[model samples]
Target: MSNLLKILLIEDDAIEVMKLNRAITSLELKHQIIEANNGEEALEILKKKEILPDIILLDLNMPKINGIEFLGILKEDDTLKYIPTIILTTSNNQKDLLSCYKIGVAGYVLKPLKYEEYVSKIESLLSYWSINELIKV
Candidate 1:
């Protein structure tokens, strides 16, 4: 895997987007975050085949084409399925967790209420991925 990573962030909430941005910035990692408000927009981006993200940060709740639906479509595609997708959701529901894992998500992480805890999670996640080997397209 490359040292610099391109991350696709699929989230509907603006405040959550801001928090993620803040967390990434605070980490001081050499990474690029591409944002999409919903799953449909993210699919469009993926279809373009311009710049494929190494990892995806997905949210379960969205306006249209929620994360579970998106994951189904993504995992069906041979090329896209290789990208590691992690669920960064506020939902602590057991059903949601089971659904995500069953759909083959890389990780399911609950969103922490505190900024410090959130940052810590992001930092650890990024650090781990940075060292790991990723499939090259």
Candidate 2:
């Protein structure tokens, strides 16, 4: 991966976003994070960008559009399908997991309920992506 890799985070919860930002900032991972409230907003941001994100951390539940539906649309687009997407959601339902995988998500992470655990998980995810084979930077 390159030193300038960027992460797109699609999450609706304000507290969760804050926690993710704090955890990522604390790590100094040489990654820039872009935020979106929901999948629809995220799609809009993506449409305007010249370069796609190296990784996407997507939440399952949201207001405008859910993660699985978003993934369906994203994968169908030739420009977006190559970017690896990781599902990060509070829901651990087997059906959800299966659906995410079926739609070709690169990874699935169940949100840790506790703040400390959440930080840890997010940090670990960043680290994993940094060393992942699919990453370009």
Candidate 3:
């Protein structure tokens, strides 16, 4: 794994975004975070091909193009499908989980309530991805 990574975070909640930023800062990992308030915005970023992300942290519910819908489009795209997409949402619905997996999501993680728990989960997730053999764009 490389020392630095580019991460695309598609989350609408401001507070959740802040929390995630804080967690990443605490870990002190060399990473660049590109944020999108919704899936549509993320798609635009992907289309630009300016900065290809090593991983994507996606939220399920949003104003436009929800996570599942976005995943469906992304997985069908030959170029973008290779990048691992992980669901980090508050929803624990069984149907949501099953649907995301069926669409080829790398992981479906429930967002923890506690700040510390959130940080721990983010840390662990990042650590795992950083160590894994990811395909280079």
- Of the candidates shown, which would achieve the greatest lDDT relative to the real structure? 1
Displacement of the residue 111 alpha carbon in candidate 2, Å: 1.0
The worst-scoring run of ten residues by lDDT in candidate 1 lies at 128-137
After superposition, the stretches of candidate 2 with alpha carbons farther than 4 Å from their true spots are: 1-4, 135-137
Candidate 2: the clashing residue pairs are: 1-137, 2-137
Per-residue CA lDDT of candidate 1, range 39-121, in tens? 99999999987899999999999988999999999999989999999999999999999999999999998999999999999
lDDT score for candidate 1 against the true structure: 0.93
Name every residue pair that clashes in candidate 1: none
lDDT: the better of candidates 1 and 2: 1
- In model 1, how large is the Cα lDDT of residue 56? 96
Worst 10 residues of 3 by lDDT: 1-10
Q: Write the per-residue lDDT of candidate 2 for residues 64-91, one digit (tens) a residue.
A: 7999999999999877888899998889
Ranking by lDDT: 1, 3, 2
